[model samples]
Target: MKKLKELFTQVKALNYTDGEDVSDLLWQLICYSPKMPVRLQSQQLLDEATSFTLEVDDSHFSHSVLKFNGFIWGNGKRKVLITHGWGSKAADFSDLITALRTIENLQIVAFDAPGNGSSEGELSNLLLFARATEVVIGTYGASDIMIGHSLGVMANIMAISETAIKPSLLINITPMVRLKENFTATMTFAEVPQAAQSKFFESFESLFKVPVSYFKLTDLYTEGAAVKHWLAYDPGDKVAPLEYLQEFLAMHPSVLSKEYAATGHERIIKDAGLINDIVELVKQGNKQGN
Candidate 1:
C-alpha cells in the first residue's frame, strides 16, 4: 500500500510537469474495487440458483463490453431484484433469498456488479454498477421490487432516476446522501496524496463527463419512480451515518425507516430483524398494490 501511495506521488509529479493527466492511474486507484469472498453457506445457496450473464449497454464509453453475473431463484408472481454494496456480492443475500422463498410463486433475481463477485472487469464505479443494474432490470422486469445496500442503494437510485424503469418498491439499507464527503474520506483513509485527490476526480469526471456531484442519491430524481421506499439501517454506521439520511427523511416524511443499534455498516444487510422488516414491507407493499 505504501508503494502504491508513493507511486501516486510520482504520478502526481509527472501529471503536473507534463500535460499528461494522471486520470488513468488515478482511475485505477479509485475504481479498484475488491471482491467479497463467497462463504460456504452462500455458496450452498448459490448451488441451487440458476446463474446468468447479461451484457450492459455501455457502448458510449471506451470500456470493453461488460456483463453482470447473477442468479435467479423461484418462479412466482412478483419479482424481487437484490443488489450488494462495495466489496459485497449478490450471494451475500443468501439468508434473504431463503426467506423470500417462503412466498408462494415469487421470483428473486440478483446480480454481481462489474468487478465484483463473478462479474467481469478489473475496475468499477458507481456509474458502472448502476448501468449494470439497468441491464438486469431490463432483462428481468421493470415493475419488480429492488433492494440495495450502501453504494448499491446509490446505484439503484441512479439506475431508476436516469431511466424510465419504475420499480414498485425500493428498499435501501444504510442509505447515504452525498458523494464528495465519502469520496474524500475514502481517499484520505487510503492515504491518497493530497495533490492526487483532485486528479482522481478529474479522471472520474472526464470519463463520466458529468461532475462527481451527479452521483449524489439525494439529488437523483425519484418522482413517479419507486412509489414505495423503505430503509433499514443502524444509526451508528460510520460509513453512512444516520445524519446522512436526515435531510432525505425530513424531505420525504412518508418514507418508511427503522433504526438498528450497532449492526455496523455492512452487517445490517444480514440482520435478521432487518430482513424481517424487509420481508414485511414487501408483504405490505403487495397487499397495498405497490
Candidate 2:
C-alpha cells in the first residue's frame, strides 16, 4: 500500500510533457504491482460516470464481455452507439451524447472497451473489439448509428465488415490509417529512456492480460468493405498524424471531412459548433433514409 501510494505520488509529481509517454508510469502502477485496490480504484475512476453491465459470452475464442451504458430519449426507438479510443471509458462520450440528446428521436449507447474500463477481457485487439461491438449492437436490436473515435473508428470499420448488422451512418472522429508515425513521434518527442521504453512494452504484455496484436488502420482498409456515409474530423493535433487524414481522404473519397482550425483531438468531441454540425449531418442522413 505504501509503495502504491508512493508510485502514485511520483507519477503525479513528474513533469510530464504534453505527449509524454506514460507507459512506464502505468507499468509501475499496474503491471509490476499486485495492488488489487489500486487497480480497482483506477477502474472506478475510468467508469466514474458510466452505468453498465457485463454480459459475458464464452462461445468465442476467448470469452468476451460487453459493457454498455444507454440513455433513452423520448420513446427510445432510435439508438446511436458510441465507442471511445484507447484507454478511454464510456463516459468519455458524454459531451457528444449531451449534444445528441437534443435530438428527441435518438437514444445514446456508449461502452468501455475491453481492458480499459467497465468491460471484461484484458487485451485490446481490433478483432475482439469489433466482435464485442457487433454483439452489443445486436443485443440492442440493431437500432444504432455507429460513432467511433480513433481506435474505435478502426474497430467500427472492422465491425461493419465482420457483422451482418450495419449502422445507418458512421461518424469517425480523428480517424487514422496507421499508428506507426504517431507512435514513433510520441516516443521520440517524449524522450522515453531506452530502459523505460523496453520496460514499457514488457509492462504492456503483462497488463493486457490477454493475447491480441495491435492493429494498423491500413489492415482495416485492406480487409474491409462497408458502404455507409462517413463523417470524419481530423484536427491538426499532435496525437493524430496529418498523414492519417490525407491517406484516409485519398482512400475513401466519399468521406465528408472537416479539419478544425485550432481544436486538438480531445476538444473535437466537446466543440459545440462541430457537434451541432454532426447532429445536423445525422439528421440529414435520417431524412434521406426516410
Candidate 3:
C-alpha cells in the first residue's frame, strides 16, 4: 500500500507534464483491486465450506484463463448465491451467510471475483467481474436468489441482463448506481489528468469492447421484468451515495427499498438487522416459489 501511494505521487506529478503517457500507469492503478484481510469471524465460516475453482477464459484479459476460488456451504433445499463487492472476498459475508442458512439448509454459493480475495488474476475491472458472475450463474442454476453488495450488485445485474438468467430475487446491499459519475470521482482520487482521462476510457473500452457508457444499471430494469429487487442501503453512503441512485429510484419507484443509517457502505452488508431483512425477503421468495 505504501509503495502504491508513492506511485500515486509520481502519477500526480506526471499528470501535469505535456504529452506524457500516464494512461498505462493509470490503467494499472484503476485495475488494481486490493485484497482485504479475512476477519477471524469470517475465517471459521470459510473453513467449513467446500472450496472449489472455476477456470475461465476472461476475454477482458485477452482471453487469459484464470482460476477463481469459490465456497459452498450446506446441502439441502434451495440454493442462494451471494457475492461481495470490489476489494472484498466471499468470506466477508460471514454474518449474512450464517443468517441465510437459518432460512433453509440452503446450499449457498459464494466466490471471490478475479483479482480479489483467493481468486486468480493480478488486476480486475467491472467487465472481468461481470464475466465471472455470468460464468458462475451459468454453471449454477439461478433459481432462488442472487445477493450482492456494491460493485457485486453491478456485476450481478450485468450477468443477469447479459445471460437473461433469472433468479427468484435480486437483493442489493449498498447497490451502485450512476457509473459515469462514479468513474469521474475515481479519476479525481487517482489524480488522473483530464487529458489522460479520455485516454484511459479509450483503453478501457478497447480492452472490454464497450464504452464506459455501456454499463448502466438502468439496463436491468424493464417493463414486466420477472425478477424482483430488494434494495437495502444507507442514504449517506459515501461510496454509493443517495444522489447516485436518484435516477434509478425515479425510474422504478415501486421496487422494494429499505433505508439504513450509520451502517456506512462497506460494513452494511454484515449488519445484523440487514441480514434479518435479507432472510425475511428470502423466506418470502421461497414461499412464492413453492
Report lDDT per candidate.
0.77, 0.60, 0.79
Q: How far is 240's C-alpha from truth in model 1 (Å)? A: 1.3
Candidate 3's C-alpha runs over 4 A off are: 1-7, 223-226
User: What are the per-residue Cα lDDT tens digits for candidate 2 across 1-290?
Assistant: 47656766765565655466776564454322211222444344334433545453533334545443333333456667887776565656656666676776776677766555545554444454566677677666674577888778887877776676556677788875565454444444445445555555565456455322344565565322434556556556667777767776777676667766677776677777778778887687667762
lDDT of 1: 0.77
Output the number of the TM-score-best candidate.
3
Q: For candidate 1, write residues 215-270 as lDDT tens digits.
A: 77666846556777788878788888678688778777667788988988888878
Which tens-of-lDDT digit does each residue in 73-158 have in candidate 3? 88756778887897888998998888887876578999998888988988787777787887887787664678889888888777
Ranking by lDDT: 3, 1, 2
Candidate order (TM-score): 3, 1, 2
Best by lDDT: 3
TM-score to true structure, per model: 0.88, 0.67, 0.92
Candidate 1 weakest ten by summed lDDT? 9-18
lDDT score at residue 161, model 3, on the 0-100 scale: 73
Instruction: Give candidate 1 regions above 4 Å deviation.
Output: 1-25, 57-62
* Cα lDDT, model 2, residue 166: 55
Query: Which regions in candidate 2 have their CA more than 4 angstroms from the true location?
Result: 1-52, 56-75, 120-128, 189-214, 222-227
Clashing pairs for model 2 are none
